[model samples]
Target: MNAPWKSGSSGGRDQFAAYLCDDAAMDVLRPIVADLGWQPEKCCRGGLRNAVQSLSVTASPNILLVDLSESGDPLSDINALAEVCEPGTIVIAIGQVNDVRLYRDLVASGIHDYLLKPLSPVQVRDALTHAQAVYSAPRSHDAAGAKPHVSTAVIGTRGGVGTSTLATSLAWLFSADYKLPTALLDLDIHFGTGALCLDLEPGRGLTDAIENPSRIDGLFIERAMIRANDNLAILSAEAPISTPLMTDGSAFLQLAEEFRQAFEMTVIDMPRNMLINFPQLAAEVNVAVIVTEMTLASARDAIRMLSWFRAHAPQTRVLVVANKVQSALAEISKGDFEASIEAGIHLSIPYDLKASSLAAKLGQTFVDANRATKAGAAIRDLARLIAETGEAQADSTAKPSLLGKIDFKAMMPRTRKKAQAGG
Candidate 1:
């Protein structure tokens, strides 16, 4: 008889391997083995890594079945598999028993799918099928040579409300927390703070792409990307003061479109003054996270901008974010800001000056620098909400790494004459 856990679904188990420790489970799986139609080379047992290594040499793409019922070290085996499993490896673990914590741990450690022990061939087949579906599914734009996904434009209604900071932090969050591939495309043109915000040095960034759009492609763009993580990439502004940046041009918009097509998620920290072609960009974007504070001046600008977008590009989603919501000084409430703008507030980010300033100076995101800080918590909450709604909410604590802190000016060796001849 099949294991009780086995179900009806084939689970999309076309070309996958199943590792079984117990003879009983192995025997149960034996009958369905032919039905699975997996390559003989794909099946094996020892540890997760051995199966992973088998697939690595083959490199033809296969599902991994790790029998975790054995007495050997579990964590060690998992670590070994983690080292070899690149982007495509779909790992399914056969656990000893139904343990919630173990399931969570395995899932957290990168296993694609999991099942409890007393494995039935049907259950194994189902898991394998599900895994293959994920593997064979259309590769996200993140992987090389794929069409990019939607882009988010982070713009400020008023100066100093932390648009750059929000963009930087959200990029970090989406890449780090969700494990979604993300690219930060700094579109602020001249005087963009994205490079400074991420603490990345400018070396043929957006400027190069804008000036030479014809030469841009996945490989060229890949080289331009600074690795935010395995999942996240960043393209900073071209040199802020480069003479080529002075003219209003269509090239910038073209670059943005390329970014939109090249990344799973692209975030643009736009310049305050909308350049001539930016309206084209704004219209094409998936989400525009408009940052505003409580003051009347900021609110007025935000309203005007909202109205312009509403009239010109009604199809795009515009999220009016009330940033720095908290203040010692009396300011208009969230309700008032929404009323004045005639647009609903999408998210309210509290004012945490201390954390925000530290993040800016250190060139790290607030979510990284101080997760415990109010601002950091707010951003995390906001990120989760956006991910759920498939929306963008105007969004920092991150401290720059020691290496990230070095700048062009600091890198140059200072010539110290005789320091007053040893004083």
Candidate 2:
């Protein structure tokens, strides 16, 4: 039982390694792995036996792909290898037979997934991509039995409700004030303003990552983000208006899982048009903040969104933020709004046109412009509440770090700068 398997002779090690018994399968898998940016040390034709022997001597990688087509008894071969495989290792079996019973048995015996033979490049790539997701899942629990990362989704009931503003502020506060590594992802590819709001240029890699999710990794993510500071990074794409934005639900979910693994906090500014994948995205996050105005139309839309969340993703904590609250305007009362929506108002941001416009003109966040203002204070409180809810225990008096500070004047556009100077 204590016998060690011989390690592979290959000098380099990789997070994902594969062992194939068939020459045809190896030919198909090698280039796919290379294209995915994985440098697997062992890609030889020893099959499951070779993999078992190799893993016995060396530590198992996060993901292990083994071919069981040649094994007489695939189940028995896998059981023997299970003794040496690491506890959290995700095993993906590629075999010649397409038996559902065998596949079910392998999964029951702790295998992550199974793939049939004659694997094309796309088939092998998708299987490995899914395996990466499983390996990246937060398996380690904290003292409170919570995952290490915090995922927050900011959804607007309708457009022009300052949802992006709130999401950006929360992300900035998490990185600057709370000193947490945060990722701000704006799902609105064409009309997204998260980068512009933060005075950072939109990156083209985001569109590439979304379109080709199989290529997403640490290096890809680092290249995709527009680094605002040491702890804060923004991921958004500014495609042309005519550019067709098409995406599947699985891509968004996979991307979100990767973000969760990469950052301490992940804040998403969801697009209003992405209703098809909104529920799936909301299910993955720890909290969902729905932004709405005080008008009846906004309240009606908020109720519909709330009902959908309750029916689909009940486990996710939901918070309703009433934005642009103006006492002069004829709007619904706070109590009536809560009663209609069946959720309390977690935050109520007073309408301050002057302060909001000034912050936008300067390309600075409201909290950065003046943290003591009503809107700024409310946003800070929202960030603190989200942190506390996620069990992140942030100090009440925390301030922005030097690296996190944004020079709004320098970041301002030349036209805006000239206009401001003339004024």
Report clashes for each candidate as comma-separated counts: 18, 1
- Which digits, one per residue and each the tens of the lDDT, describe model 1 over residues 1-423? 111221222343335666656667666655555666656544455545455455344432345567877636665566655444333445667766554334434433555555655666656665555555556655444335543355677889887888988888888888888877788877666667776767777566667766654445456777887876687777776564646453333345445545655556777788666622334445446677888888989988887887877765565567777787775663787777678777788777788778877887877877778688877887787667566545332111112211221111111111111110111
RMSD of each: 20.9, 12.6
Scored by CA lDDT, what does every candidate get? 0.60, 0.72
Q: What TM-scores do the predictions have? A: 0.55, 0.66
> Model 2, 178-284: lDDT tens per residue?
99999999988889999998998997977887677667766788888898879999989999888786554445655675676578899999975565433445545
For model 1, what is the error of residue 33's alpha carbon versus the real structure, in angstroms, after optimal superposition? 58
Cα error of candidate 1 at position 115, Å = 58
| Candidate 2 lDDT score at position 74 | 86
Cα deviation of 10, candidate 2, in Å:
18
- The window of 10 residues in a row where model 2 has the poorest summed lDDT is 407-416
What lDDT score is found at residue 129 in candidate 2? 74
